[model samples]
Target: MNRLPRPERFILVDDNEADNVFHEIMIRRAGFTGDVLIFDNGLDALAFMRQDELRVPTCIFLDINMPMLDGFEVAIQAAPLLEGRETTVLVMLTSSGSPQDRERAAQIPVISGYVTKPLAAALVRDMMSA
Candidate 1:
């Protein structure tokens, strides 16, 4: 595994705890030696992102089908928080492989890309290298 330049911090917003754990492992496997903040829901993640004391994370792994506010909704709502944070990238990590979902995510300027579930080290490495 090759080491890539890591961000100051990383954010994972997914309702599934199992996926979060798996994604964390994948991130580590990809050699991302940075803080990983896991949020079970979008609302909390958005709140944390909006906090003045909070540093903008390098990457945000967001699941699209969360309870309170879905990934699409968060992308729309997070526009303000994302502004001026060009280094921060938001990737939609969801189980849904629907083309409709991908198209919808494409419409959202906040979303950098859409990825399927069960994040892997290779994918993490690719994302980091990008």
Candidate 2:
């Protein structure tokens, strides 16, 4: 994969621990040498996003289905923190490729893209460029 601009930090919000591990490897393979912050749930991720004063994430890979709060809920709640923050991108990363899900993502202003899971290095490269 071609090199892409590395974000200061990459945030991954997924309940699945194994997926987080795999995605981290993919991000690195895409030549992203930055902090990879993993969150098991949306609430924690929302909190982190709200509290972190220093840097806004370069990219946020959020799962559609998760415990304690789904990705949509997080996006909705984080919209205030995310709006007009051009450098930050919120992406829906999930196993489901349902059209309904995609439509919902469209309704959310914060979501830049909706991608299926098992994140690949190529996809990461494409996303970074996007």
Query: Would you give me the overall lDDT of model 1?
Result: 0.82
Candidate 2: C-alpha RMSD after superposition? 3.1
Q: Model 2 reaches what TM-score against the true structure?
A: 0.90
Best by TM-score: 2
For 12-49, candidate 1 gives per-residue lDDT tens digits of: 99999999999999999999887899999999998987
Write model 2 residue lDDT over 1-60, tens digit each, in one string. 112244677899999999999999999999888789999999999999888763544788
lDDT winner: 2
lDDT on C-alpha atoms for all candidate structures = 0.82, 0.85
> What would the TM-scores of all predictions be?
0.89, 0.90
Off by over 4 Å in 2: 1-6, 54-57
